[model samples]
Every structure is written in structure tokens, then in C-alpha cells.
Target: MSTTPVEEFEVIIVGAGIAGCAAAKAFGTDGRKVLLLERDLSEPDRIVGELLQPGGINSLKSLGLEDCVEGIDGIPCYGYGVIRKGETVEIPYPIDPETEEQAVGKSFHHGRFIQNLRKAATHTENVTVRELTVNSLLREDDSDKVVGVSAQSKTNEYFRFYAPLTIVCDGLFSKFRKEFTTKTPDVRSNFVGFIIKDLELPLPNRGHVVLAQPSPILMYQISAHDTRVLVDVPGKLPSVSTGDLKAYLEETVGPELPESIRVKFIEALQTERLRSMPNGFLPPSANQSVGMILVGDAMNMRHPLTGGGMTVAFNDIVLLREFLSPENVPSFTDYETIAQQMNSFHWKRKNYCTAINVLAMALYRLFAANHDADLEVLQRGCFSYFQKGGDCVDGPVGLLSGLIQRPIVLIYHFFAVAFHAMYIEAKINGWSGAHLSFIMFFTVLYTACVTILPYLWSEAKY
Candidate 1:
């Protein structure tokens, strides 16, 4: 590892995740002196964020990384689907095939995406890839204005690298952000997965979220024709150090997956455990503190559902590029604040994801529920809400997307539901409980039948 500060490093980006790399690349492309740091020099391994949303493609195209992005063999995702109560509604991606439809299904391997982005960042002039483990921030004064970083290689002397502005892209649990700013990660992550890979499994080209049974399993095609299953199993979260991950892989995917995929997945889990970086996806630029700006998981951590994480990082970079574009030399302090307004899009989607995630989990639990009575309650809830387009006030998805700026709109969704639920519950009579329960239960079955029966009759309009 090289020591000594190069005259003036404009931006020091810690962590080489999508957000960090993109921001560095942007600064570099503008010909600014930048340093990109990574904890492990080795390539990133197994992780989620495999399904790149259509919106991700749109973002990448703007960054000029879209064409080669597929060079990583990312499988393009169609759209979202839900399998609830043994019924599945697979939404065929609504892209017009005449244009970029062919490229639309490219699903990104998170590790692969990181490698590709790192390649682009390092190759760009003015960007230096610092392969070392970051220990702490380089503060100029006691106020915590991040002037640079303190880092070291495996067995090398420690070095201090300085920069006027430092961007911490250090995944989630960002020590940098906590040290400098007041932005706390308020997002609570609930789902964890047993990710296993195999070559070209015999599955649909489109993605499927199987909530039909308990412990929701989300399967999507990945970088290779291989697939990754995000199986949501609940109980005491298994220990990571136990090497329990390998045995867990066998029990979860071996029996359910096809033979070839099963074999491949086994080999991957055993050999591909990421001993390096933390197992989480990247995020957009979040907090802006004086000389430090928090990007990726260090700031607004994304939910894995929509697959927009990496692309959002790219979008953040574009913003950083524009801000640092020599034509406009805003103070590094102002740059931090501007990064937030620039990434309003990501936090917007966070709002949407928060609710849909709840919906997905609740639906998964209902699908897996063996108790018929409790299930009836869930069934009624789902059947009524979806059919009515049950708006949770303004709805979380809208808020997360930044479409609805005010968070208070999410509260309205609750108030509306509260009133409606009260009216329904007040009307509950003796066996009417049984009757209403029956109606709720049957309606789901009926909706399924209607969707199926109409297509059978050639009169179904989805």
C-alpha cells in the first residue's frame, strides 16, 4: 500500500461498492483527483440485488455503463410477481420489445457488478483505487469535518490519505457517517436469505416471488443463466460463524431445486462464502456532512425487493459529477448538502419499499399459515385491499419513490384503513364472523379462479 498524500485529492471515497465507485468515476471523468478504497483487494462474492429493475437499466443507460453492464452477463428482470395463498400472479415485464427489450432482462450479479464498476472507476484517469482496509476517518479538526481517511494493507504500516471532501460508501453500519453526521439509518431490515447458485437452472426466464408457502422464496435468474433463491426462513437467525450456512443451503434449496442447480448451489455456498465485505447491497448518497458525504449502504440502505440499488448509486455519481464538474466549484460542505437533493429519488423509493416489504412479508406469512381461522383474517385483508387498490394513505411505495415528498402521506394510509377496518369489525355478528371469514377466504380463491377461468375462455383481460 502506498503512503503520502498526493497534493490534493478532491474526493476520497471509502468502500468500493456501486455507489462509491460510481461517485469516484464521476469525479474522475470530470478530471478531479479522487481515491477509491476497498477493504478487500479480492473480488466481491455472493450477495443479493441480482434483479435489476427496469428503472435501473434506465439509470445505467444515462451513465454510459448500460452496454457493458450486460458484459457481466446480468440477466434482465421482467417485472415483479407475487405468489400468495397458492396463487401466483406473474407480471410479464411490460417493455416494448422493439427497443431495449432484449437488454431488459439482464440480471446483475452484485459481486460482478461491483467488479465491473471497479474496473470502470480504476481505469478512469484521475481515479486511484486504494486497495486497503479503512480503519477510521481523517479529521482536520475536533468538529469531525472528514478531510481524508486512515487505512492500511494486510501487513503494512498505517497511512493517512487526505482529501478536501470524503465520501463514505462503506456499506451499512457506516462508522464514517456516525462519526461525522447526525444521519442515522432508520431503515429496519427484516429479511435474510440463503443464496445458492447453480448453472442454468430449468426455470422461467421471468422472475417469480413465491409467497405461496410460508417463508417466502424469491427466485430470479442471475449473471449467468444460473439462479439465486432468496428464501425467507424465520426462526432464530442462524449464526454466521457456525458454518451453518452450508448445511442450511442443503436443507433449503437441495430438495426443492432441480438436480443441476442443486449441485451447483452446493459447490457455491461451500466455496463462495464472502469472508471479506459485509453481506449487503449498495445505496444512494444519503447524508452530507461538511467535508464528508455518505453514499450507498452507509446512508439510505435499500431494500432488496425492487433491485434499484446499484443503479441508484450510479445516479448519485452523476449528481456528484455535476456538482464537482469544475464549471461549478461549490465548497465541499455545500457538495454534501447538494448530494441529498440529488439523491431524493432513492429515499423516495425507500418509502415505497418499506410498505411493499411489509405487504410481501404479511402475504408470505398468510400464504404459509396453516391455521385456517387466522388465515381468514389475512385473506380478507389481502382480497379487500388489492381489489379496492387499498391505498395505505398515500401508500409507502409512493413515498419511497419521492413521488410523495411528505412522509405524513404514509400516515394517511393508516387512518383510512383504521376507519374502514373499524366499520367492518363493528358489523361482526356471531356466525357472521364465520360467514365474513368464509367470504374473505372464498374471495381470494374466486379472484384466482376468475383470472384463470377467463384466460381459459379466451375472454380474460388482465
Candidate 2:
């Protein structure tokens, strides 16, 4: 049997998705030899990570990967326009007037974005983009550190590659994450995606969210002519015909969208195939054996309702580069030193990770509230609070974008929304009676516990 050649690299990154490509660009720019492996080099067409929050855009710029987002026919997202009770409110992405750079998001085809990042990595002199499938991690006889990987080329040829650092960026369905951590992601919901063509939306640069019965539906323009719509379905959906799905959207959610897009929404739903993706959250942690690191969806994930996955991944790459680059940490090449550095890096990332993760999960619950009375109230309150405008909108949007790392800020806004809902309830039902007072008290308590406590628990463990 003929054996393929063995090669070496400073860093070996698996899966050439956003995270892997970003890592390659960062490390390669620093003159470190990087091997970026991807199963397929083509642009991805599936739904997920289609939007880049302002925080993620900043992180991309920080890594010098901002060019990846440019010239991809992306739609600049100002903020979000939420529709509830036949009313629409436009909430702009928080603007930091004092700072030079303005915060904004972008929505586009996921595949194009991935292709752009891959191209960026490929253009880096020290990064080699290889279309290969990583079979497994190569470890020392008795050590837990993963020193290399065994992979196969497209032609069915096997190969071995060793590196000082191995990064797993295979994303949400990562096969290697189990080797390091036992935590399984909580499958919270699923998203159904389709494209609505040739429609002029009410808010051109805003993501449109409709609070429909059963769950919320998100609509945003991906290109000049195509708008992407994602419907959040809580739990596993039983098998239903395409006609059933079309009817569901037309009856429950399609009316909530702008009239111009209603016909297109119905048409998009008529197609035989609709792409579905599970929304999951894997508690964020920096736990990895020596010489091995996990980044992006492989390490942590959150609900996608806020479109924060790419933001988290890009920020993670920036942080990883800051800590592991020779200019910052000289011992980055050593196994023990690298392991310790990652441990410290984990704690350093606590603030941003906590804020982003909690915000995504919490926001999804609020947006996708189908049957829960308190959550339904909170959802209405959230929309009304945003309609009132000012800090209420900016602060929460900042948290969603990852520009704001303070968890307390998120807590404050969440309780404020809850309180606002309580006030509305009290006003509508009359606060004179003991029954109303008791109801108000419990509503406030329940909202606080659900929104604030889960975030606290995650932060503490983080």
C-alpha cells in the first residue's frame, strides 16, 4: 500500500466555515503556516449565520477580514422592524456617536459570505486552503493533547498532518467536540427557510420580525432581489405536507408581513422543498486538552433569532489571535503554555459570551412565545418598549449585537420590559383589586426569574 506524504503546519484548522477561515486569516497574517481544511470548497447554500451584527462586523474588521463582507451583495441592516398586533415599529441598531465607527448589521446569503471568507484565507500567503475531510484527531500515546489530524483528500487519498495547535471549527454539528466536553446542545427550536423574490419591503435595511401565532417569523433581504424568510418552529415538527406549511404561513404569519411581500411569501412556501435548521445552544466554555482548541459553533452556540452566531465566532477568533499570537503571548507554541493561555482566555471571554448567549436564548423565547401567557405579555411589552424608543431600544440592541458586554445591562433591560408589561397589565385590568396585585406580582417574578436567572447561572459557570 502506498502512503500519502505527511506534512506539518503551525496551526491546523478543520472546517473552512466562518470561524476556521477567520482563524486562518489571523494566524496566516502573523506569518504562521496554517492548513485550513474544508470538506467542500463551494459556497454553502443552507440557512443560518446569514446575518452579521455590528459587533461581528467590528470583530471582522479587527481581524482584517472585513473585506470578506464587502462586494458580496449584502444588505446593510439598520436594525429590526418588529410587527405585533398589526403594528410595526422600527428599532435602529445602536449608534455610538462618540466613537468613530457606527454600529450596523448586514444580511446576505450564507454561502456567499462563507465563500468570501474562504477566499480571504486562501489569499493569505501563509494559509493553504485544502478541500479535505478530517477523519479524526491524532493524539499522543498517553497524553490528552491532540497534536495533529488524519484526513482524506477528495480523491480518496489519506494523509496525516501534524501541528502545534489544532483548531476545531467544524461548526454546529461538530464531531470532535465530544472528545473534549460531554455537554450536548439543547435543541430549543427549528427554523424553516425560503426566499421571497422581487418584493420591496417596508423597511429596506431592517430585519422584519412578525409575532405570529405558534411562533415568530423573520424576514430580511439577502440581496437586491431576494428576501430570506425564516420561521421559528418550537420543538420538533411532525411531518406535514408543503401545502400545510403554505397554509400555515398564509393564515398565521403572512398577513403580518408587508402586503407587498405577502404574495411572494405564499409563492416561496409553495415550493416542494423548504430548508430547516435546528436552533441549539451549547454552553460556552474554553475547556480543551493541550494543543487543541475549539472555536465557533463547535464550542458554543446560541439561539439564532438574534442572528449572533457569526458575531460570536468572529469575536472568538479575534480574542484567540490576541492571546495566542507571538506578539502578545510568546509561549503560544508550547503545549502547556498554550493550554494555560486558553484557560485564561476562557475567563476573559466571560463577559461577551455571557451577554451574547443569554440575549440570543432569551430573545428567542420572547419572540417565539406561542402558548406561555407571561412570555406572550413580555413579547408585547418588548415591542411596545422598543416603540417608546431611546435607551430601551439601544441598550437591548447593543446586547444583541455583542457591542455591549455587560450582562447587568441586559438584566436591567429585561426587567424593564417585564415591568413595563406589568404596568400595562395593571393599567388595563385596574390595580385597585388584590387579585390584580397578586397577578402583577407573580408576572414580574416569573419574568425576572426566566430572563435574569438563567443568564446568571450561565455567567457564574462561565
Best by lDDT: 2
What stretches of model 2 exceed 4 Å from their correct place? 99-102, 240-247, 250-252, 255-260, 331-333
**Clashes within 3 Å, all models in order:** 22, 0
Model 2 poorest ten-residue lDDT run: 237-246
lDDT of 2 by residue, 1-462 (tens): 244888999899999998999999999998898999998998788877889999999998999988778898999998888887778898888778788555788988899988988988999999998898999999989988788999887778898999978999998899998987888789977888888777677788998888877788898898998888888877775346645655665677777666666787778777636778888888887666887888899999888888888988888899899888886655446767677778878988877878888888888778777878888778877888898999989898888888899988988998888888877777766785777668777876687578667756865775
Please list all clashing residue pairs in model 2, or write none if there are none. none
Worst 10 residues of 1 by lDDT: 453-462
Model 1 segments beyond 4 Å from truth? 1-7, 96-105, 180-203, 212-214, 223-225, 239-288, 319-376, 379-462
lDDT of 2 at 177: 89
1-462 per-residue lDDT for model 1 (tens digits) = 557553457788888877787777777877778899898857776556566655456556666666546578766554444544434444444434357342244576677777887888888899999788889886776675667778888777577888888878886667666664454543323344444554553335666655423344566777564566665444444566876644655676355544544576567666554222222222223354567766666665434544445554555566556655676665454654555554563454444333333333333344444345445444444433433542531243343222233434644543343334333443553335566566544644443333223222221110
Candidate 2 RMSD to the real structure: 1.9
For candidate 1, the lDDT comes to 0.55
